[model samples]
Target chain A: MTSGLFHVPLWIELVAAATGGIQGALFAAGIRDRRIDVLGVVAIGLTVALGGSLMRDVVLDQLPVVVSSEWYLLVAAAASLLGMALQSVLTRTEWLISLLDAAVMGIFGAIGASKAVAYGAGSLGAVLVGVVAAVGGGVLRDLMANRPISIIHVGTLNAAAAGIGASMLVLLLRIDVPVGIAGPISAVATALLRIAAVHLG
Target chain B: MTSGLFHVPLWIELVAAATGGIQGALFAAGIRDRRIDVLGVVAIGLTVALGGSLMRDVVLDQLPVVVSSEWYLLVAAAASLLGMALQSVLTRTEWLISLLDAAVMGIFGAIGASKAVAYGAGSLGAVLVGVVAAVGGGVLRDLMANRPISIIHVGTLNAAAAGIGASMLVLLLRIDVPVGIAGPISAVATALLRIAAVHLG
Candidate 1:
């Protein structure tokens, strides 16, 4: 267990990981100009699924849960492979890709913020960690692919949406709200903002 | 003290950080085509100076010395700013840049391997950490600049030289060599190898 006071349910965390893997794989596959091989694509997918967790644990000075737990790696790898297989069929479904991306960002952001709160970080610090965790993997992906960092280059509200979600979670925890209630609210809010931005544009 | 068994001297670590800062700033400034602002150049400089140490500490599941020690940040930032100021004068001194780059990699690699050994990692694991610590910052810099990763694309012996240095340190430690002696030897060996590759090429 991560902590006695706060922990995301295993199934919920797994779902988030799975979606992250799929979304990352699909995103990597969409980059056709680069000479990214199959293995490269899969690696990017795994980064999306686990890189943020590794970064979060490292920043907190703890062993990464991704490395310690066998299930996370196995699930992420499987989901990444599954995503690769499905990419051809889903190539045209841009909305679905956007939805998964937003959902993954939101879920990861909330989890990161909640963990920071449990670790007793100040509100701003917790929110910072949450935003990093939300966007770290995408940054890594862009780096590996030699592409511009999406959060920095795109005028989209990706990081702002994550910041809002993370801030909300931190605020909720400050008032003694249970993590269970606050976490989902944070995730949904972030996802909606992101989705709204994309749809409106 | 990082550990009772082994630790790099504060002065030695500072020198490495300073060199890394200088090298990183020079490297960033050389990319004239990119629209990197002054702050961007300095941030990249800081990344090269501290990113590897951050990665190494995170992998070892310990708090980053770069964060905990005031000296590291101060020295790195000052060195980065100094490097930026000297860029115009040093623009033609390509050899100096390469030398600093090699030396920084070697020093960081040796320190990382030595720390992992002190932390009771296996030989391979220690060496892996060393290579990552040596090359991690450069990778991040390239990523930020939207360039192909230098270590991966350059076909140089950068990673190999670092691996050789780290492995040598691990071997010396296994035979009960004092870290004080082993560390410098490792650093020198890595630097020479890298320098040879550049000159010979």
Candidate 2:
């Protein structure tokens, strides 16, 4: 019911959705053993793109932004198709995919935390919501694709990056910092941490 | 926000949650390859018991009842522990587990549809919400357990059963039938269909 709680620029949100969709589609398409059809690939991609926002809205007791906004689905679907088309090229460059994935997660985390704060959720709840929003889509995607959840598995520190970024944003907000300034800073920090974890491992 | 929308006896809801918790724990404990700890089993069981309700509340833009009500979590946790203790005995009886799962899905579907109707959702949305509520927990459980989602895979008619029951409940509610009668009838129909599907297969 509450609109505009996602105070970020529309273009930034679109970029995040596109990034998530592409990564999710690529992940789905790369699964050789499972027989996920074309529709399933698109569904998984949309889940990744829109799922975080949906979960965040639901947690804040608002209508899911993805369901209420037509553009969100359109952008996600388009990006999913593009990702499917480019799966061959995208799969070869693992580093690029990981980098993009981390950035997207950070964006989602910042947005989710900001919205939760706007809704008057406590600091701890906001951080948890942000982490859930960052990783919730991948959880849904992995479930649908019949693969291990990337966040929980002994891989990169996906959740840790989201948590740290969200906590930083919350702390900055408490200090009267503009969301515009805090959001990108948090996102970049998360991206750097995630990239470091992946490279170091 | 809407407290009494469930409209079911407290005992019935407790029974449904207990059944789901036991079945979920048994399922988790039976996974031969997965290294799920006792805590994981408890978590999965709680997800199965309370996930549907949490999802339903979120979709309806209401505060999740699970988080709001201490009783919900307490009952779910207690039932989960009971399931864990009985896992060895329960795993040996597959038919019993399937029966309980079907019944739990039915109860959740009925409760969800009824609540959606009470909350003023359209009939189609109510049915969809009901099915999601019935299966959402299992999807979460499967994702956490790193297993294939049972609803989407080509196996039992899990979502189908929930959808059918939810639709029936909505239709009955439209005819001015009380939720008490409509809910049980729909649940029984779902359970019967599920049981028949299992036996015939």
Candidate 3:
């Protein structure tokens, strides 16, 4: 019944999905040993783009937005195709991919936490949901590819960034901040933290 | 709203979860190259046991029964531990594990489809949900172990068995059959089909 509470502008969600889709496709294409065909790449990409939001909705006991919304699959599939087309160029620029990945994670984390809060989950639950939304896609992709889960394995501080951002939003909301203001700030904070972690390491 | 509609006796659900957990743990322990630790084995076991119900609840937009019920985790963990202890003996007898796996899948499929119909999903959706519930655990387990998904890869008619069982249940219910009779019959049909597939192969 808490439908539309977590709805950001369609463009914003599309941007997040596109970035995630592209990143996922690139990641899949990069696997030399794995015989991932075009369909597999697309499936992996869509899974990365939409998996977080799907998990978030499921956890909130709501109909998954990806399944309900008409535009979600179209955008994700198109983005995946674009990513596959540009795999050669995308693979060469690791830094750009990293930056986009961080941004996408931030966007997903903010939306997930906001939705959880709207659905009356506790602060801790909201934070956990946010992290799951941020990294759930990557985990699915890794699983499908038969690789170590990036979040659990030794890798970038993916979960940490999402957690920090989600916690900050929760703190802000507790202090009477509107979700409109809190959401974007949380996303930017997550993105910056992720970028900083990548650079520092 | 349909909270109590799919409520089987607690003991029946427990039996399914315990068997699934034990089978999952045995499967995990058999993977010599994975080196899954105690915690990992337990996690995988719980996933296999509870994952189906969780997915079913999520799809139906209801609170996940495994998370809501206190007994679920305790039973799953205890069964997993028992499985690990019996691994050496279990390994020598692969037939028993396969039989148990088939039964667990059937139980999950029957329950999942029943719940989906209770929540007003269409017949196709119900069947799909049942297949997902049946195979979802194995998929998760395979992912955690960094192995190819068992259902998608060549081996058994996993998804096919679940689909047939779920469809049979849906047909029975539509034809005015009692759920108590329909559920068990569908489950038994699934188990027999799976066993037959394995034996023939």
Best by lDDT: 1
lDDT of 1 by residue, B1-201 (tens): 123666667887788789888888888777777565565566667778877887898888776677456588678878888778878776485777788889988999999999898888889999999999898888877776677887888835888999999999899988878888889999999999988878776
**What are the TM values for chain B, all candidates?**
0.94, 0.92, 0.93
Better of 1 and 2 by DockQ: 2
TM accuracy, model 1: 0.63
Q: Output the worst ten-in-a-row residue range by lDDT, candidate 2 chain B.
A: B1-10
Q: Which residue pairs clash within candidate 1?
A: none
Clashing residue pairs, backbone N/CA/C < 3 A, model 3: none
Model 3 has a DockQ score of 0.17
Best by TM-score: 1
Per-prediction TM-score, chain A only? 0.93, 0.92, 0.91
lDDT of 3 by residue, B1-201 (tens): 233466666777788789889888888877787578888877788878888877777777887878888998789889888877788664474776788789888998888878777776666657767776777777777777778876534343666678789889888988878888988999999888888867765
All candidates: DockQ:
0.15, 0.18, 0.17
The interface root-mean-square deviations, each candidate in sequence, come to 5.1, 4.6, 4.8
Give the whole-model CA lDDT for all candidates, comma-separated.
0.80, 0.78, 0.79
lDDT for A51 (candidate 1):
74
CA deviation > 4 Å runs, candidate 1? A1-5, A9-47, A54-107, A113-132, A143-201, B1-4, B7-22, B33-47, B58-96, B121-128, B143-149, B152-155, B167-178, B181-185
Q: Output the lDDT of residue A141, model 3.
A: 78
| Candidate 3 Cα deviation (angstroms), residue B164 | 9.8
Candidate closer to the true structure by TM-score (higher is better), 1 or 3: 1
**Model 2 docking grade:** incorrect
What candidate 3 gets wrong by more than 4 Å, as runs, is: A1-22, A33-47, A54-100, A120-129, A143-189, A192-200, B1-22, B25-47, B58-107, B120-132, B139-201
Mind sharing the TM-score for model 2? 0.62
